[model samples]
Target: MMQLTTGERQLGAIVLIALAILGIAMAAAGRTDVLGIHGAMVLLYSLALLFLLFSSAFGPEPSPARLTRYYDDPIKVGVGLTLFWAIFGMFIGVWAAAQLAWPILNFDTSWASFGRIRPAHTSGVIFGFGGNALITTSFHVVQRTSRARLADQFSPWFVLFGFNLFCLIAVSGYFLGVTQSKEYAEAEWYADIWLVIVWVTYFVLYVRTLALRKEPHIYVANWYYMAFIIVVAILHIVNNLAVPLSFAHAKSYTIWAGVQDSMVQWWYGHNAVAFFLTAGFLAMLYYYLPKRAERPIFSYRLSILSFWGITFFYMWAGSHHLHYTALPHWVQNLGMTFSVMLLVPSWASAGNALLTLNGAWHKVRDDATLRFIMMAAFFYGLSTFEGSFLAIRPVNSLSHYTDWTVGHVHAGALGWVAMITFGSLYTLVPAIWKRERMYSAALVEVHFWLALVGTLIYVFAMWNSGIIQGLMWRTYSPDNTLVYSFLDTLLAMYPYYIARAFGGLLFLIGAIVAAYNIWMTVRAPSAAQLPLDEDLPASDRPLDGAAPTPAE
Candidate 1:
């Protein structure tokens, strides 16, 4: 069993004392209920820290190791967590989708209300599912490309465990009605504080690992992931600046109010999509595509261009969400212009991904995992183009507060983010578990089609419904009175909602099949393990069977 070192023990004791003080503070402030939720979160973080500290002190001494030893375990743990959470997160997504079709499907429970569950679904997928995937893939890419292990084993575990614990607290608190009510920044003060510590740990670990890298060339994927981690840390802190009523409590009031709050929230919200979702996933694409295809990236120059372009342009596009609002006209115009420019970089990345499959098209057909990734690239292109169009003032006027925005988000989330995550897991599981292959490739193909078709049906139906509702709402009946009653617009949405539910059901079925496949793979007899240092050519691998070049 692991045991804590003197330093580690001191850290644990400090954390406990901090929690106790925070609890007392909240109770004194008459916010005990809020403090209880946050206290639970604090306990979880403390537990994770304790595990790390003990492991560092007393776990079996690591072998005389190269850089790979440090990162490999962390990568495996992170990947395992990603796979575990994918099913749960996607399940929540299907549930939320069903609620749109039948509001009563939420069971009229406060915990399962549309408002609460929607955040739950989003947080589950985005932070839980997506976050795990990003960290796992980023760790893998960083280690392999840099030829270095992570800087420290315990630190990685701390970041992973603590972040997930924070996610748990944030999601659970939402059901309990503890929120700052910021769009993507909804977690109250306690979760925010824990996250700050976890994020700082992550930043430190990454920087330390980079410092020890063997390669002079920092891989493109690491660049994107670094940008994501850095920018998100800043964004989170800025947008979530709130004064807690007490130290232990989850409840807090945003320092900003009214339109200023709205501006800050959306700015953080949209960039969360940009940096967290787009940038991080792009990192995955950069590494996985080349690795899976067993080919050089199509154009390194294009990648550099896209990276800078996206970084510059995406920051300004958030204001487009607030077009025609109280925001200054120049800010809105800047958002519109930058959003249009965003198409260039977005497509550049997509083009790079597709072109990387230049000689690897056969693998895409045979490998269900590769197909999912390829299709994700396709959807990324489609969604970005749609996003650019939606950001236009005229388009925003029509689509705002309607199902169109919903459709757009799902197109990106389900089609792009979830698909890439699935692809990454499919690639990761067999490799990590030392399995020769998946439980059933045919089942994966079925899952792919189900998700693809389901996403299409869901997004397209909502698009049609949203456009119709928007048009009807804007139409005046001879005089200045509204043309359609709110109920009439809702009535118009029923059929589309039903279609969306059907699509969501299909997607859920796909996720269930995937979960079953993973479970069987875990249970099945293990294959002979390969030597860690064995340097097999890409052509020797199942996924990347193309001939290896001298450069490799």
Candidate 2:
């Protein structure tokens, strides 16, 4: 049997004992109507406990050396989970899109209904997939740049597993008709509390590791990650302020009502995009792009400038989501102005990314991973530009309540977020796994084309559909009367909706191919592991407790 650490043994014993008690309670509760959705949750938790025990009893033995350890195990697990959730989330997204196109795909079941699964799809992709990518990459990048092992071994594991636990609860609750009704903040109060606990631990662990860094200055990537952590905590707690109806029922009501609630929700929503999608991924981009290109960043000062600009500008931009509604006119204008101004920093970073590749365009041609990052940078610039345009009051009037917003989002989500993420993973996976390269670079080329083609199809379809809908809605029939009924708009959307679904399916396929390639890479017979000291340039890998080295 593997020797478990004192913490591991205690944790395992607690879980084992807790599961035994909960299993009995849940078995009784199953016979009662009051247990509700928790009965199912109880069974799941019990099963999880069983798996925990099996692993605790029989998993690999603990290593003896602490300082010499690279802390790659949890990161490796996080990478695998990232791929799994990406497939699961994108698959749900495809299904939800099809329901829009065909309507009959809902099939009259609550779980299958578009209303229920739409949240599932969003949560799966955004929180499940994207969130995991951020956490895992942060773990990997922090150690590499800081050149310190994580502060506590077990705490990192707890952060990863605990966050995933919250994801599971949020996803399951959505399917079970348990929600708080806020867009992107739908997980009920209990899940919200659970997440707060996990997030605080994550924040602490991150700070602790940074404190132990051997280098004098904290790396730029850590700055973005730190901002993401701090700002997200503020947004989550403030926006999710609610009173639960009861502990037994997964239901809650927001503390704020009316316009105040609208303000709060968008504050959380827009920043979720800013911090979650943009900042975290931008941090990942900063680390991965230059590393892959084997060049120094184009301008470190520009990175510093862009980071501050995005951090300051995005906080006020959420109110743009509530424009032309009950939100005050000045607040609406404030959001529009800030959002439009955001284009400067946004393009600055994008241009910075492209310029880093000044001498590496040839590598971009041969290396699909570089191609993914390059395309991601281009799309990041394009999407941020589109976002600024849409934030203008008049443009918002046309794009608001139309599929145009959806197209814009997919452009960022698929184009910027997913594309860069795939690029990073391709760069990181083989290196961490001690492989010369991916199982097949050929498959990577196939995936890049599939993802690019899919994103183009999806974005153009929504763009065309949104403009048509906007034009139809505003068209006057000679006397300032509405020319088209709402059904006419719905009718007009079928072809575009079909195209969107097809595009999503193609993206999903590309993700699966990537996942399979990663699996094969991990399982392939090891070509001797690369020495940690030699894996990166000496400037990039500072020794713990040593002074930093100058970059070439």
Candidate 3:
């Protein structure tokens, strides 16, 4: 059982009392106009407050400790949520893609329109799916590298449950037409507040656990994850600065106006992609790649260099998204310059990952998990190069509103983020379930090929169509008139859209195969004994009894 400190209890009580007082004041003001969604929000807030108070009063008690080793139940729950939400989120993404390809797929429903559903897809994948995966894996990676059991089951559960609950509110509110209308920051003020609380708890738990690590050296993955958590918290608070219309329902306006608002939003938005999608996954690659390959990291200095370089440069690149907009010319120039500079660190990590597997190519041939990770690294390199190129003003002019941007994003999201996630999940499932091996290596191979081919086709088709659309949109006739109607551009994209749909389908099939493989592995009977080879050190194991060096 875990116990709370007196200070923690007092803090919890104070928060609950404050919430109660606020609720009563709102009710007394007769400001029912803001009470619609705000009222519901207040109730939810009160409930969360009460739950925290109760938790502080009586700390968590484990459920009998049924397993011999502490099973890291919080991580397990987080993993389960990740899988569940991944499927749901991806389904939404595929549906949205289909809507893009075929307008009628929206079924004329307001809630299902592209505007409403697009944010849903983004939030679902980024927050619901990727968020859970990152939390789960961070917990797992931290415990393993640190050689320490998690601090407590309850706090982890609180972090996971609270985050997912926030996702639920945010997504539901989007469909209900409640929004701040900022891209990626679309969630209303209440949703943002909930996420802030959940995120702070996550930061506290993560920092505390790291402080208690049993290992001598903190692994490189921890650096990336820590950067992600801290930077994101800062970005969230700053970009989400808004005055609530009322607290009873989901309504608020961003405090920053005009070009300032755009600057803040994209600063948060692009960095959200950089830190959340890129940096965190890079951390996964750093830890998992060498562990799976059973080899030493290729370059320690390179990893450190890449980590610092990326951290310094990425925060500025968000301004590139505001290129040719109301943003100042100097700011945009800085964004462009930093974005270009980013290629060096990005490729440094990519090179380190690929080089780490110099003698492990044979394993890649047979290990589906390794294949996913390796391919993910390859795409990471590809996407970063593409991102830098896209950030150029001339290129941005062409690609900004075109499907090319869409293609570029999916190349990163599906290829880099999704692939790395799948690879990590593959590595994790057996260990978590105590299985000897996956159910079928052949199915994993099939999945790898399907996803790889699908992603390639999808990205290539979009690149081709997007360039064409951009050129056509910009071209004027000899008489200096518009050369193409919007409809003509739309028609030109039909083939590419169809190709994209096919690619998405193929990827979906691969995911399904992966899910089945994971399911079978989980269901498989435990081996009579653990494999001895699994415990053996590689021939090139580090001397001096130090931890293995981390790959970039």
Candidate 4:
């Protein structure tokens, strides 16, 4: 609170008080239901924040010297939260995988059931882990690229913590049976509204920071980050449009019904993969990859082309997820076509990242951090190819609703998204903390191998299980009856499920190792001999006057 001015302190109190009042209102309205419990949670959350605010209010004001440098406290906190969510999300994923292999693992608990925690795992990893990574990395990236501290420090922390609260509400709601049952958009109406408020604040903060930049042009990474923020808000608001049963309840009816709902949901779903998973991470790649490699982008023009290609093509490609369903044949074909076209840009990006390392492959061999990025680019290419191929109607016939789809998504998620993020964090952590290097370079190498082997095992096991399951369903005797029952296919999945759980376990362990390494790095005494390192990327430098003005 002391970091902020007196006016900011008053404004903070007002917001927290309003939130607490709203929570009380929700509790009063939904006293007989789970909604009331969540309302109580909100009350506690707000009051906790309020107390922390006032408790810190007596500290001395921030020095004007801070204005000359970047605002990185939020980024530091963000990195820790990212790893925390990664460990949590991956653990849930392993548990869910085990439940699939052995149903008894659920212990007959409703909250522990696969159906509930499945969304929880997905949301936790994607929005919780991935979202925090994006925010923190972007906060770091935007400052260097723009050559200015954030317009103010308040928005960064607010956006980061606010987004995490939404994630908590979302994942917790799943366990409590409080969802509206939309796939990635599963959070109930109140949570959805809260996210809109948070997201808008993020967008405004980003743009305002950019506006303060000394550079005349926005960096390519910022372009992708901006897309992630803007498109997700659009996708979220549109597909999740719903009329709540009442403010007193968590239940709501989506405005779209039947096939329309399916179409809208999938449209949001696949593109969530595009904008949220792909674009934001690509932003990480655009900035961090070259920095770690110490090479300029191989082709700035190609990067621009890939950016525009992704922005234009990905929106329509979402319909591919609805293949072989009630969606029109034309829509399916269009989706397939666009998805294939998407590979062009996707490969362009992957190739761009790889080609940037043409002279620096030795770094990749010597540095686990660079290898993490290298493998991510390779997987990005692989997953996009698989996705485009899977969208074909004939191919979809075999892969749709099969474990193949699950495998493909993980190929992107575990392989591309998680890999690149870890690589970036490894690079970011040392610089931010003014350390010579990580607490243990060997731990990073350990994580890299574990993540890689785990991803491969998980992806390959699902591939085998999915193909067998798909083939069995289509196989028939001369009598024209099915050759295998659904139970038979279900039974066949157990081995693969076991393999998947093991792979997820490896990934979870890697996350835990990462968290410990980061904590030790943070807590270790700062190295006084090291030079001042903001750890800014070299992709862009600020103009002479880009420094924060005294008034700022």
Candidate 5:
């Protein structure tokens, strides 16, 4: 009755044991530090996983026939975890936004404070929610495009659970006041090291699977995904170079300092947005958008152009964030220039996604899921343009350190990133679960409108709030003295802050609706279900007349 192969069970037990030992050492070494808490977590979670693995070991081995279909169990768990993180992350985000509008919500508890939960919200959504979605879809997309199963069963689960473990440790540490203090790289040295291990395995898993592809030519979606993995690995290693105070302690000093640190961090940071956020999801869009629309990519050449443009232009543009600062003026100007140039390819990619729907506009009109993807493309075009414009030195002067930057980020994040993910998941969930459709198509429409309205409200509020802040800060009276105090600006922001919080709440509610819908979809009885098969499963594409279409 084992759901996994004996080899897989053995591997799971071995890995969990190693993690347990590491956890024990951590507990002993860092009893006085937050490291101890993380250690306890690692130990407990490892034990739980071990228990689950062994409990199913008493039965006969799973049939090798599973190898006949796509390796989908990991994909199934990934779908659930993705929705789980979406709910958790989005809820925390709404709470954080609410805290900003109403300072009293933190309840005077240190753990509940804004400073503590803010990073949790960021990591929870960015890494937890968005990261899981990327990993899940990558697994699904790779198998279909290659017309091959995952290279192995074990590595997929390792990457999934290991990455989640790192996320848990990173976010939990923030509640304990342990951070390396870098933007988007806030997890301390230990978590960063763990992520590196998981990511390397992920890269190998992808490359190895692609090596066994039945298709002669690799697909464009795979190209973007590979770019995401390769570039992010390089960026994470470089930006996170640091020396821990001790193996037991969570604190660490970065290898970089002053302006050099700033440059390296953004070099990692902006490209993180480029590769992790943009490239990976664009991969999702490439495959799911076309498949869902039942259309080929409009212009294969445009996809390539956008891919290269993003890869090249985004590296230098991080400097634009440092405009009018201690960093060299020339560097700032260079960042600005590349950021502007980035618009061409960004627009190209967006256009390609939209153009794929040429004859499918009627489908888009009728299907909320398709509309989600279509609007995601529209927002992608808009947000990239806004990013280039804001990167201008003069614009950055006004927008920097204000809520406008926050608004611009969500315009891409909530609109482009989350929207595409939701659209794809809606399509992917039922297919993987072997259902006819979602539990409720009507609910999808409901979630779509909620998400759209929420994003608009949230973004517009920040835009207005940020502009007002900049103008007030820069304004002068006839006597040439500044007209507004910082306190005055703060007071003016309360109403917009309320609006932002309300919008965020709406988005969170939408995620909840999605969670329930997908949950029911999985629960709904289906007579035709893929038999849970074994390692290197073959897909039924050949028999069903649904061959793996080239996802160019």
Candidate 6:
């Protein structure tokens, strides 16, 4: 367990007390105003304060002798929170989908509108689910690869709680109709500023840990994570450069305007995918895939090469989203060119993952976790390829406003991002908790199927609907007039929307089961624990005198 210093404990207690007081104030206001969103935030803040207070009073027992070197508490908390946010995010996602299919589900309330909750859902999953996963896994991977504990114990908790605090504020603001009108960057100036503070602390802590490494060389995964953290911070600050109307108001305006703003927004948007979603998860893939398969990476050289390649190419590729817009044609072409080039590095990483499993094919069949990682790799290749293709002007012409882009996004989001995360969590949760195995390997299998089938259903439905919509929009009548009205396309998409909602429901169910499995594993008797030797595969056992490598 983490041993907090006096200052750290005092800081934590003070923060909790502040949150509790804020919650009490919010609850009082909510009761008088009947403000649903404020009531929700009050509940969240109160429960969080209670949980922190309880944990501080009665912390987990100390790490056993065998685990003396590692710091696992932050990783454990992160994994649990990742599960919670994922389920919460996807639930909102499914509801949002249902509301689109049947608008009545919006309940005609401003707070419950699809517009309000859409950002909530996106932020919940992206920042809440994916962000926590990256932070937790980075801590785990960085420590293991460097052969060092995190540099500062309190910092990880600070990052975890501070980042989540920003997420909470962002989501609550969305429900309260406060935003900066940016797509993924919708969090208002105050939340954005808070995130900046939290993120800088995160970067300092990460570098500090790396500086303390006992290993001779830093691992490949850390490079990817470093890029993720650094680039995201840069992108976030630059793109969210907004001037608030007043300190008392949530409204703000971006520094850039018109075509420049459009360019900057997509520049930030696409790279959010590149950095926040792709690069960070790639870090997870690099560490977990080899460990789960009981093999070394196929090529450290390839990993390094691809890392540089992705970082360089992905930044220039965001302009593709601005194709055929008011932006200069030359800029669009530049984005298209770089996006296509990104395929090489993207595929290199995917190939490296698959090739690492050269002799572990049987493990993929037997180990559900390995299957998740392997499939994630496959889908990573597919998603990147599809991304490059869609970036082409001609392709974007058909896909930009259609559901095809939506399908493509999910192909990566669900197939690659969520899959790899689920895989890593399964591998991580057990090790962090010092469990012999998951409470139910069978349930992991169930999750794999549900996720796979759900993704297939979701993507294919969107693909079909998107294509139909696009073709209909482009079609001309015998006299060179439009063949179908916009409403016609909207009506055509209903069935597919219904289908997509069902798919989301399936995925949500799988996540719930996975959460339950994790909870049960954590609760399982210590008597069920196996020896360390029994937990590792024979092939994974370190040979005598072998120096510790990244996965080892």
User: Against the unseen true structure, what C-alpha lDDT does each candidate score?
Assistant: 0.80, 0.87, 0.81, 0.89, 0.90, 0.87
397-481: candidate 6 lDDT, tens digit per residue: 9888999998999999999999999999999987888766787888899999999999999999999999999999999989999
Say which prediction, candidate 2 or candidate 4, comes out ahead on lDDT: 4
* Model 3 lDDT tens row, 524-549: 54544433244546653333332211
Runs of candidate 3 with Cα error greater than 4 angstroms are 1-71, 528-552
What is the per-residue lDDT of model 5 for residues 302-390, given as tens digits with 9 covering 90 to 100?
89888888888988899988888799989988999999999999999999998899999999999999999999999999999999999
List clashing residue pairs in candidate 5.
1-59, 1-60, 66-533, 66-534, 67-537, 67-538, 68-538, 69-538
Candidate 2 matches the true fold with a TM-score of: 0.92
Pitting candidate 1 against candidate 4, the one with the higher TM-score is: 4
Instruction: Report the C-alpha lDDT of model 4 over 1-552, residue by residue, as the tens digit.
Output: 346766677777888899899889988998977778778988999899899889987777777787888888889989988998999899999999999999999999999999999999999999999999999999999998999898986777679878998999899999998888888888999999999999999999999999999999999999999999999999999988999898898899999999889888988998999999999999999999999999999999999999999999998988888877888989988888999999999999999999999999989898888999999999999999999999888999999889999999999999999999999998899888776677777788899999999999999999999999999899999999999999999999989999999988988888888888788777654447422354545534333342222210
Positional deviation of 312 in candidate 1, in angstroms? Answer: 0.8
TM-score of each: 0.89, 0.92, 0.86, 0.95, 0.95, 0.90
Off by more than 4 A, model 5: 1-3, 529-552
Clash pairs detected, candidate 1:
67-149
Candidate 2's residue-wise lDDT over 337-411, tens digit each?
999999999999999999999999999998899999999999999999999999999999999999999999999
- Where does the lowest 10-residue lDDT sum fall in candidate 4? 543-552
Model 2 clash pairs are none
Of 4 and 5, which scores higher on lDDT? 5
Please give, for residues 430-536, the per-residue lDDT of candidate 1 as tens digits: 76666766777777889999989989998999899999999988988888899899999999999998898788778778877887776666545443543424577
The ten-residue window of minimal lDDT in model 5 covers 543-552
Q: lDDT (0-100) at residue 547 of candidate 5?
A: 19
Predicted structure 6: clash tally? 0
| Lowest lDDT block of 10, candidate 2 | 543-552
